[model samples]
Target: MKNHQNPRRTFLKNAALSGALATLTSGVSLASSPSKRAVRRDFNLNYAPHFGMFKNHAGDDFVDQINFMAEQGFPALEDNGLMKRSLDDQKRIGAALEKNGMTMGVFVIDPGFNWKVALTTGKEEYKEAFVKECEKAVEVAKIVNAKWMTVVPGYFERNLPLDQQTAHIIDAYRMGAEVFEPHGLTMVMEPLSDNPHLYLRHSNQAYMICKAVDSPAVKILYDIYHMQRNEGNLIANMELCWEEIAYIQIGDNPGRKEPGTGEINYQNVFKWIDEKGFKGISGMEHGNASPGKEGEQALINAYHKADSFK
Candidate 1:
């Protein structure tokens, strides 16, 4: 019952498995090739990328990544989590963007979850917290020369009437707008996909809130990815809410990845936006379906392909 394999045979079998694994991994690496040069395209405004997108090829350094993005012809960058970065890091990133001729896109001043506290509750403490955040956001905007910050109205208060909740959001946004107006900064409210419990979950809902806020500082951040998932008629909805939209974000639906990897006809979508004469940056807020440098190249290629629909 204690039969054992010969020593030489065992070694050979282990070696074979190790070699097979190495071969499989190498094949994957080759298939996911990296870009040899930055992608170049003819488009209006700038297509923004967040940090870590090019880290593998650019060596985990923000400056190098910015240089790579610039080389690829991207003229803008966005960081939703930029406020979490250290002050020195923010300054360095800002400098890199400037040196690369890139503009900063929207960064979070009061991402919906925290900012919504004031809008939903109307408690003085929460209102004070939100105002303080707005004050800090303005300072950060000045540091980076950022023009826009993303905002959200938070969860739907089940106990409150819908009209009452809407009124509360308006008050909170008006307060935020006042804080940003003096500094020439804008607060962009984003509508999330239908999750039932979420308060601000549609472009029309956001458009209405923007109207109620009644300030130029309050505008919409139209994220096509979320909208496609929430509402089907993309072009029509965008056109309808065009007046209040200040910025846009892009990602293919089903899988929040690059353009060509999903069902969204990004080429037509981009063309429509361009035809509409949008001047704001379209934040590339998705991930690559593939991995590593080659995947990155594919992502750039996809954008180029979609953007070439002129």
Candidate 2:
């Protein structure tokens, strides 16, 4: 009896091996082979990798992870829960970034992912509380040498009219803007597609609020994953909201993983972004598609594939 065959799987493994071997021999920047590190080179776009993306390869230490990202050619780092980190940790990460010459990308305005008081409720108290959080964010930003911070306007209130909710969001953000403006920092509001209850969920909606606030400190965080789920016309909508977009995040839909794991053609998207002369960060806001060190390598490979869309 003939042995069972897995030709497709075998072919994929062989192809990956070939790519790794080629990258190893070439004295050029590319995803590192598991046994050897890739030569560090400047990527066309400043792609930012988030914490835990390379943990298997870099180990559990935060600074080690950052150093690994820099070694792998990632020029920036973004952390979603940076506010939760202690002051010492923040300073440590900052020094590490300085050491690596890596730019600090967006961290959430506050570590609290959910708000007890919705910003869209049109309440003065909630607005005040959010403004205070923005103040805290400024100090955190200063410690980390960060310029952009992520903002989520909070839950959608069914009892209130859409206009009222938008108005409330604008009011709160304007106040938040005042806090960040003096420090030359930006509060980039992210529109999520995770639930129907999210107040900010579309590029145009964020654009509208930003225009009303009319502050340099307030802008849109065009997260490709959520936007892709909310609306399919990724490039067109991004183009429409281009000016208001200050920071960008990446996650492929169907699974909030690396770029090539799902429907988003990140290559074309990245190519378009590069053409527009965007000097800001394109954050890797997604999880690794696979597990362990192999998964980390795959994430690096995905970015290389996406970044090659020139």
Candidate 3:
């Protein structure tokens, strides 16, 4: 008998191996079988999720996460720390967002670092620092193609009256607005959660400051999570300050996690936003209550569930 095997047998063995390899390479397994139900949902506006929120599922790379967010149908993405990123990183991020058709939301520029005092202090040194930071923020905004940036006026100066502090914040913002206006950028001021020490802790306070600033380049950030913590009437306060609000941030209170993780009824809130015809990005500046890829999927699902309301 010849040592060579039968041609048909050899062909059969090779065909079976190829089939197995195809299934393995295509990620088809019993666990990966398609389910009858849809696993994801969609939202109407630009619902922005922050960087690193989906790292485990989307890999450590920022561009990879951006791509994943786009694939998963998130209309926008926000990086609060965009200014901290390198110029190259910012350009790359901007390019990725453009490619994925994702909108870039606010990036942190000042973040409440004694800005109220600096602007209000009447001290030239502090004012200069504030202005310098504003100038840098303008450049960063251009790099990332960001239209808005987050600003906080910091805590109130005890020696100063509330009105004085407010006036100072307005002055600081006016100067800051000048820097951004030239570049078509807006500074979205966020009122801190009521700490008793912070100056602008209430939506009304932020609203007043925005009015005082009196410029389109200056507006409120309207973070729902912090506002819900400081003041319970989410919709009413939002309505009261609606004109000044340029941007919005979302995170459930108590846990500061995705929408369904806390007591606030996000479904109703989202409905109200939709009804009001607010056409801006809602930054998801919260953390995942759970861990790993499961946590990421949960966050996605939570948004879907909350946004399911008309």
Candidate 4:
């Protein structure tokens, strides 16, 4: 049986999908040369790397990167901008992940999500857009064989009180939950710390929102980098939101790069998640600290070091 939802759409929305895939098949090596691996080894958990993270080693071909990740023992992948890619690319990547036994992690539900409109405004237009995006996310998830889609509830409304804004966000997410629950897809709410104006900035707030939504379809992303910046109690805050947390994303703070390049103690964090028996993907949603093959290898080595915890 074949799924026909997005088999061939040139793309009706604006996302980084095209930009990511446009260079996928270019065959350009970001490093001095392409990487050639002699063996494949499995990591401890399903830690997912994004598309261009290994372009130096894998070349610019997206499928080749997929192969390289598998060859390097990567068990999963996360594409934050995947929803913007073409349907063909989505299918190909999905097929590749399936063949390599790699899990597909979170991708943005809507590329138009970063705008200033508030879901907390109780505005019908904003709520409608959120619901539509949720519906589209279901279709996109089918194409990529993805179980999780990332969601941002939008910025805080300046005119609305904090409590009112929270309620509106909850109401909008409840509608989103209704759309996603039947498909068994989860919309993981991400509390970003990139800027101060954003609405959701803490794990506790996301946890409360998830509780308000009260559905398996809605959960928290629990990005380590953002949480570490927003608040210092990483382990405790995560434990508090543990029940509502559906996925995890990684980046060492001070620098949103791979494990060893910054202030985070990823080994401890990875070990903690491992001990907790989390069977979900930990998205490597950060940049390479070093450039070219050296950087890519460093990134890989960093993960290896972090995973060495027993």
**Steric overlap count per candidate:** 7, 0, 0, 2
> In model 1, what is the error at residue 247, expressed in angstroms?
0.4
Q: Which ten residues in a row have the lowest lDDT in candidate 3?
A: 23-32
**Candidate 4 lDDT tens digits, 197-308:** 8999998899988877667778899999999999978888888889888789999988899998888888998998989977677899899999999999999999999999
Local accuracy by lDDT, each model: 0.77, 0.81, 0.76, 0.80
lDDT string, candidate 2, 1-310, tens digits:
4222456434533443343233223334433445334345558887889888888899889999988998988878999899998989999898787666677889987624356348878777777778888889888987877888898877778888999888888888888877876666778999998888787889999999987887768888999999999987999999999988988999998899998899889899999999997878889888889999899888888888888875
Candidate 2 least-lDDT 10 residues? 19-28
Q: Model 4: what TM-score?
A: 0.86
Q: In model 2, which residue pairs have backbone atoms overlapping below 3 Å? A: none
How well does candidate 2 score on lDDT at residue 114? 50
TM-score of 3: 0.84
Screening candidate 1 with a backbone cut-off below 3 angstroms (N, C-alpha, C), the clashing residue pairs are: 32-294, 33-293, 33-294, 34-293, 34-294, 38-72, 39-72
Which regions of candidate 4 are displaced past 4 Å? 1-41, 111-114
Give the range of the ten consecutive residues with the poorest summed lDDT in model 4.
7-16
Q: Could you tell me which residue pairs clash in candidate 4?
A: 17-84, 17-85
lDDT by residue (tens digit), candidate 1, 1-310: 3223656435533543343234222211222224322234345535888888877778788889888887877877899888888999899888776555567889986633454344776666666777788888988877767878998777777778889889888888889888876555778999887476778888998998887766667889999999999987999999999988878999998899988888899888898998887767799999888899898888888888888876
Order by TM-score, highest first: 4, 2, 1, 3
